[model samples]
Structure formats: C-alpha cells, structure tokens
Target: MNQQPLSIPADTQASLLDVLREQLHLTGTKKGCDHEQCGACTVHIDGQTALSSLTIAHMVTDKKITTIEGLAMGEQIHPMQEGFIA
Candidate 1:
C-alpha cells in the first residue's frame, strides 16, 4: 500500500467529494445526490461512515479518509466487503 498523506488547507471551502474526485482523482466515489439524500458518495472518515457530498474538505484534513479504492489490500478484499459480495 502506497498510502501517502495529503496536505490540504485547513480552511478550504471545497466539498470532500470534489476534493476526492477532481483533486485526488479518486473517481470510485460517485456523486449522487449532493444534498446527502442518496448514499452514492459514502466514505469512511476515521473508520466511521460519512457522506462525502456534505463533508467539508478542511474538516477532514486532520482525519483519515477512506474511499472505495482503499477498501482492499492488493488482491485480498476486505472481509466486510466479501460479506457484502456474498
């Protein structure tokens, strides 16, 4: 895993969804309802579920953000994800 920490502004007003998609180029997190009505933009913030559409980019600077790309370890899928697949 080549996980590297991203340094972003602590006062950025951009949404987490935009940061993930446009900045980081992580397109796995889709943009559904920007109002958080749909769950398409769900992500894990410090191991907790969060709606990326509504999350502020600055608010997550001090926290770990896990997207769908981070869900697996090489060829080994996470057990929770395996369960869902089953």
Candidate 2:
C-alpha cells in the first residue's frame, strides 16, 4: 500500500499534513488540533509514528511516508483500519 512519492518544490511551505491531504488526496489522517497537541494526524515517517502536522513537506522530501492507507500489506488489511469495516 505504499504510495507514490510526492515531488515537493523547494518553494513550497506547507506542512506534511497539508501535502498528504491536499496534494496527494490522502484523507485518512485527520487534523484534530493544528497545534500538534492531539494525535489525530498521526502517521508513520520512516516507520515511526509522527505528528504530520508538525513536519514540513520539504523536510521529508526523500523520506518514506506511510499513512493509514499504506498500513495494509498487499490484499491484507491492517488491523488499525479494521474498526471501520464493522
């Protein structure tokens, strides 16, 4: 479920959450508290949970970003998303 990498222009100044949602159209991550106080927009950056709202797009230019959409392996759904099925 790895998604295609985004090409971040050097002049771009949006947060990782913005790029993930607006640019790539990934809506799994939510913006609960724009101040990074809440864990709503949590995602994996290089395999570790991170607050995407706090990270800038240019800072993660070549990093591997995995959202809820990428948690699954092949046809298997990740357990984190199973709750939505029921």
Candidate 3:
C-alpha cells in the first residue's frame, strides 16, 4: 500500500495485471476470466476499484494504485484475506 509510484517503460505494452504480476511481482491481483468478467484481478486506483486486467500499465503511472497488501496494517489483517481482523 505504501508502494511508490511506478514508472512504466515507454516501450511497455502490457495490461496493468501483466505489469503487476510480471514486473512488480505482485501476485495479489489474480486473473480469473482474463476477459474482464470475474472480479479476481481487482485493485484500487485513487480510492476507486478497477479491473487491472483491462487497464493499461502505462496509463496508470499518474494514479494511486492500491493492492490487497495496501489494506494491511502491520498487525491488522486485510479484510479480503480474513474479513477485517482488527
């Protein structure tokens, strides 16, 4: 969640999900349908939810991206992981 802004290479040509999984090694965002139907690869951008599989990596450099890890606080479990353990 405290991740720094990403810099997408100009030559990059992949979906946000690809950048996250392949480049950033963020496997928290899952790919279900790959057709933008299932909500598996869900992430937040600027406090809003978006489908990472459909988003372009280069187009999100200016946005605030929050993955499942972002919702976790040291001792606090993320809601999606364990239904909001406080």
What's the TM-score of each model vs. the native? 0.79, 0.82, 0.82
**Model 2: per-residue lDDT, tens digit, 1-86?**
15776665543678888887877788988888888688889999888888988888788877889998888888999888796465
Error of 1 at 50 (Å): 0.3
Show where candidate 1 strays beyond 4 Å. 9-11, 78-86
Query: RMSD of candidate 3 to the true fold?
Result: 2.9
Residue lDDT tens for model 3, 1-86: 33676565643668888888877788878888988788889999989999998888878777899987677778877768685233
Which ten residues in a row are the worst by lDDT in model 2?
A: 1-10
- What is the full ranking by lDDT, best candidate first? 2, 1, 3
Q: Which residue pairs come into collision in candidate 1?
A: none
How well is each residue in 1-86 modelled by candidate 1, as lDDT tens digits? Answer: 11667885434788888888887888878899787688889899988999988998888766888888788888998785575468
The lDDT values for all models are: 0.80, 0.80, 0.79
Could you tally the backbone clashes for each prediction? Answer: 0, 0, 2
**Candidate 3 at residue 39, lDDT?**
88
